[model samples]
Target: MMQEWRRRRQAKRVKPGDGSPLPRFRWWQLLSRSLFTLELVGPDGRPSSYAVDVRQAGDKDDGEVRARLYVDGALRMVSRVPARFPVPGGEIEVVVGGFGMKRCHLVAADGSERQLVPHPRSAEGRRARFDRDHPVASRGVGALSLLAVLVGLCLALPALAETISEIPPVAQAVGTFKSPLNLPGWLLVTVGVAAVVGSIERALRLRSSWIDDLAS
Candidate 1:
């Protein structure tokens, strides 16, 4: 029953797409756009293809990013992220993070899920290729991203606590506080930048935790 409500809510977000053709991904759009494709067989055993495209750096006047769904190479549906489009056997879900996409997968009715294949020219594809070609280096990079998020959290929590403790009412109740890890202003800024970079790296791999996302 709850799942049905969720499906209905997600379905309402979808709007009919213009009868326009899908755009070709270009080299310059690698940083701004993401495209992924899924292949499946219908119940009748007919093969069908679907594509999910997102423009991360696009305008957010509507207060959210949008994901466009294409069926058999024609535009079919579009919805704001985190989007869920009902398909043959399940739904195509798209979610976003601070820097880019954090999730893009097909969720089956039986609760199984699989990520879609990214376009070969896209950044995600290149990153995946890097993982295949240099597993050790890729793992090292992933480790660094996690480390960066942890360090950022360590740096952020104390600062946040100190700020809250400094408030007049809070100070009166709990006394003033200072973060022990205070370096310089410039260093704090540098760490913040690193955290953002780490968040982006994690998103490329479709990995993020609430804590890491909050810290970044």
Candidate 2:
């Protein structure tokens, strides 16, 4: 029921395109931009190409983060992140996470879904290619990223608790607390940077876990 409501709401958000050509992705904007494409055959047996483009650095005009859908190289629709654009056979869903995109997939009428392919020169595409060519190494890297985020959570949680406990109101109400795993500032910074990188890496693969993503 809730899902249906959301679909209806998103459907209302859809509007006709302005017929402007889609902008090309540039090499320097690889980290800040994302583009994914899907090719489908319409009911009339015509081939159509759809692309989803998102610029992480919020829109310049309104400073709102948005996703733009392009059809056959022309602008089709635009909406805020976590958008849904209805298409021929399915809807293209776009979602954003803290570090980057969390979802960009084609959801079919039969309920099946497939992630759109990233452009070859994009960061996501490079990562996907690496995974295909070096499965074991890719797995190891993914494991390390998870481990880094987990370690950050373990170390930061206690410190966070202690800091909160030391607040005047909290201390008076619940007593002071000391964290057992205090470390140097340098070490904390190092761990924090690693956690951030790990989170970005996970985002590149469209993988997210509450514990991992939130902690990182």
Candidate 3:
């Protein structure tokens, strides 16, 4: 007798799914922290109509619940539903309960009704994933690097220009010291070549150090 009574009680609370009288569900406090998402769709199944995300909001097991709804890129509404209740179902028109309910509906060619529940993560998650996969916004860093290179070249141009015009004093002395045998020019040329080679070696070491900085 007790088993039969319990069965009857259970049957009273859940939807029959056969087009019988639908049961009215009492709002149960949902554990907001539980991560459950719902998706609602239109008649063609290609368009999204609504979404519900469940998450914990506070110290109690029943945390505050918030949902974000969008139509195109614009936000349509933000609302809260009682935890533990299956979010309402129906086409856009049937489900939208006035100002508070985010509604979705579908009418078949035969005039039958198709109900859809919104997926909470569809549009929201897609936007986040797209941002992660595409790094176009980070191109600003590359642009700044190019600008820095240009500025450094500008500052260095003056030194390069000066080097082109001014002959080394040592070179002038060697010109004066040249003999009919040209021995002075030969010795000065050998010394100048050695000096240039040394300067090149020092420059290579400095370039290696600068490369190390870039790596770090």
Predictions ranked by lDDT, top down? 2, 1, 3
Q: Which of the numbered candidates is closest to the native, going by highest lDDT?
A: 2
Which residue pairs collide in model 1, if any? none
Tens digits of lDDT, candidate 3, 5-33: 85455334432122222122222322122
lDDT by residue (58-117, candidate 2, tens digit) is 889987888899989999898887799988888899988888889999999998999999
Q: Write down the lDDT of every candidate, Cα atoms only.
A: 0.87, 0.87, 0.33
**RMSD of candidate 2 to true structure, Å:** 2.4
TM-score per prediction, in order, is 0.90, 0.88, 0.19
Q: Which 10-residue span in candidate 1 carries the lowest summed lDDT?
A: 56-65
Superior candidate under lDDT, 1 versus 2: 2
Error of 1 at 138 (Å): 0.6
Q: Indicate the worst ten consecutive residues by lDDT in candidate 2.
A: 207-216
Q: Candidate 2 — which residues are off by over 4 angstroms? A: 160-178
The sequence of per-residue lDDT tens digits that candidate 1 reaches over residues 1-216 is 997797688789999998678899999988888999999898889998899999997556764579999988899999987799888998899988777888899999999999999898998888889999999999999999888888889898998899999999999999999888859999888888888888888888888657667677
